[model samples]
Target: PTPAAPHREQAAWWAVVGWLGLLLQVLLRVIRGAPSSLAKLLRSLGLRHPLLSAAPAVAFVQLPSKAPADDLPPLSPPPGRLTVVLDLDETLVCAYESSSLPATVRTQAVEAGLHCFDMEGISSDKDAKGRQRVNHVTVFERPGLHEFLQKTSEFADLILFTAGLEGLSCRTFILLSIKSPVSN
Candidate 1:
């Protein structure tokens, strides 16, 4: 056979595999009601209507049940100090854009020992015209935050977690560590 024939055969084989995969997916969707996204994708490809008519109905088999294990050991409390994971945004402190903060929050922030600093060199925030603007974040510590950290440190190791940007997290860590009396 010519080299072209082999290439054609391989292409035909892949086409068959692709169709089989599509058919199996269709069968699964029929067995379980199709998800909206999957239904949309099928419709977009013009395969939904044809597959619905051409595909064979698939039956799902029930899985065999297993006996519960009675020899498992009873759960025991942790041996050492418990670990406490705290979220940074609302739990330990609240960070806000300096320009939009309310008067009450600004006052409380002052009372709570707020940390205000300008963040430049990065364009994360957008202005009304959609141009990127540098961020100026003001972070306000929660009431009794220092005392809470001190007390918690005696019985537990605290971990600060945040969903904010990397720079914010680094700044938060540095600022809190500088203010915190607790030793590593």
Candidate 2:
């Protein structure tokens, strides 16, 4: 019986294909400047080989930029809560000063029924949210940050002054059970 040669050539070709695929994907990310399905797909493949893992060393995908939306529920802060203009980032949770909550925040907001911004940060300018103006922000809240939220909601209006994506922010706030009473 003829000896069967190991599938070395086939394996080598597959590796090459994988590498090219990874390279093209990297280019696409550079052009788009954000994470894409391909990256996640590759990660899910569960390949542990160094060759597969090191195919693309550079991460070109840019994290999606969070921005406010047009349909935000009209805000109605507490009538006499003392508009404190509290910060939601590191000032409270003490992390990136841009991420939201430590899961603790969610709990506190839920318990207190306190409203909070998911992605809060200073816009590039006051009019950044305008159609012609770009909404810009520089901070975010932390995860499990109910403890942090408890401190702020205790005494302030807690308006989110950020350029983050409104939907994302609202979703987080809602999940936290943060609700505002409609008041005059």
Candidate 3:
């Protein structure tokens, strides 16, 4: 049996109302994307959005509003070679942080025949420490680190700086397969 015409009209009106509600939601999203809109909403709640506060300070990136340079000088060569410096501990080795040793480095060195060595003490072997000594040593490098070091060095100069023992740096780099750095 065909539905009554009045019922059909009522169903169409409900569908139209739902569509209007969806369009209104899209409009709300667009309006909310504006920083000012967010700021106003935040203010209404007795708060200031921190990002909005600092944005104006950096917003206008046009030429300096103040006086132009009084005189321009010819550019001079940079003082030294373009050197990239990297830290050995966190930057090169993966350490446990709170534990005595960064797990990965310690394990790698041991497997490579480093015996009676403690990660806390910067030692290549038991005899090197002379006795029970404790110092956090970055013994190995991060994974996939050799390829990165090689590729980077082949292009630009790289420097690996470490506060570890004088000789430790060499062994550490070797263990990590890091090539001789452009500069130490």
Candidate 4:
């Protein structure tokens, strides 16, 4: 009777191990090949499976080289006006904080069509003390800016680009429009 009891206990343990092995095998097979729906779900969430990482890298198309200048036909002038891109900061106008403006600049301001005005409600910058500082900006236009813009506009479409903040750029545009007849 004792020998029979030992054999039964060993058999029960083997049965439990067999069932566990079968369950693990089924789980592994499911993971190895995910369902189409699961793959779509992963794609929607911008995720890639490990198997995709093992695939070859994508090939890129090669663009044709540009033709040499000598090989191209003689070019005629465009029927429409040409386009001109102008830089605003130093080319058209120079702006500086009121407190930092030089004495020499102040003397030439009148001749250069300098416009001094206070910009309010613009608290985008901070000072050395970490407090918001909205100081007055003084703009000095180039000596022949109006004449240059006028001449360029007659033969080209003018586009202005500025490195200044939006508020400053808008203010400069307004000032230029108000002062220059060519801006109209």
Candidate 5:
């Protein structure tokens, strides 16, 4: 097994036939809709200039523009100012992790008057003497959440959003005091 193992197995079988001939020339230039040009597909796979001087001699295609929605530009919404976006966890409230909450579901949601609270955040993790942990949550509202944000802020412009963890929805909207003007 020497003689440089048959020239290192014929240079790893021509480096797997030069990466399967550069992935069959990029799958036949993406099934022939062509016009790619990574330096003309590495100079049609003979690949030179040290791999065509690091590619990019035009290959940014875009395409979509049959133009004709009356030359597009009229997605409306601003002749009366209405915004309303809302959705902070389960739509308008329902947190939990106050150390795995459950003191009889926080005393039956505070004797069923609901509208709970207890947010507090700050913890992208870092303790063991680096400080920055304090997490606790709780939240709860969502029974006509403050009369649907005071009747959608007297006609839209509410926002609030959260795909989860914007520091626990900005500490559940500053512990649900919400006088608005939150920002980021």
Candidate 6:
């Protein structure tokens, strides 16, 4: 390599860092409702230091100025309504593979009058013969789950968030009598 290779690489790195710092500063200004000029922004962020003074400009994109709220239409839902986001596993209910769940625990949950249901889900793993397996899951509702849903749905829109399979999540919400506007 040439003697100046390291210096060139270092300068390039600083240029990238400067660009990222400038973008972050702009975003922070927008969030804080502050206005700034490009030169003033760079000076304020210390990007004009001797080490970065010779670095080439990274980007020249122009950011749009913030518009007045009065000039825009209302984007939120009606005042009385709100969004209620709930997670599926461990938040609203607990689920386990029927094969792995102990019989005693199942019996105790049933005896305790905790609402429970069974659903079949596809396994992400291959079976012994290298074929996809169907997993039977037993889901138990957390205490006061029903009442919480009833009260929350009264004045808010409910959204279910889960990393589980789409079909499995939809089926669970269906069984719970709640709408599932689920996304991955």
User: All candidates' lDDT scores?
Assistant: 0.71, 0.48, 0.60, 0.71, 0.73, 0.77
lDDT of 1 by residue, 1-184 (tens): 8879989999999999999999999776663464466666766778656444434578689875764577557779878977888787777877777678777867766776764444433346778999877777777777777778888888888888888777776777677767663332
Q: Which pairs clash in the backbone of model 5?
A: none
State candidate 2's TM-score.
Answer: 0.24
Model 2 weakest lDDT span, ten residues long:
175-184
For residues 6-81, write the lDDT of model 2, one tens digit per residue.
5776788899999999997777655345445654566688744343343576769786576467746888976776
**Comparison by TM-score, 4 against 5, better one:** 4
Distance from true location, Cα of 14 in model 4, Å: 99
Angstrom error of the Cα, residue 87, model 5: value is: 14
Model 6's lDDT to the true fold?
0.77
List RMSD in Å for every model shown.
16.0, 26.1, 17.1, 16.4, 17.7, 15.9
Better of 4 and 6 by TM-score: 6
- Rank order by lDDT, top first? 6, 5, 4, 1, 3, 2
Off by over 4 Å in 1: 1-78, 108-132, 181-184
**Model 4 lDDT vs. the true structure?**
0.71
Give each model a TM-score: 0.45, 0.24, 0.34, 0.47, 0.28, 0.52
Residue 33 lDDT, candidate 6, scale 0-100: 49
Kindly list the per-residue Cα lDDT of model 3 for residues 1-184, writing each as its tens digit.
4679889999999999999999976655554456566557766888764533434455565886666566557679867545678787667665442355556756767687543222443544455547744445434445656667777776668877887565556656555543544455
Model 5, range 83-184, lDDT digits (tens) per residue?
Answer: 867777877788888889978988988788887878787778889999988788788887767766776677667777788767877667775646444323
Residues 1-184, model 6: lDDT tens digits: 9999999999999999999999987665553443346545776877664332433458578866987788898788658768878998788989998999999999999999888889998877889999988889999999888788888877778787888877677778887774323323
Candidate rank order under TM-score: 6, 4, 1, 3, 5, 2
Could you tell me which 10 consecutive residues in candidate 1 have the lowest summed lDDT? 114-123
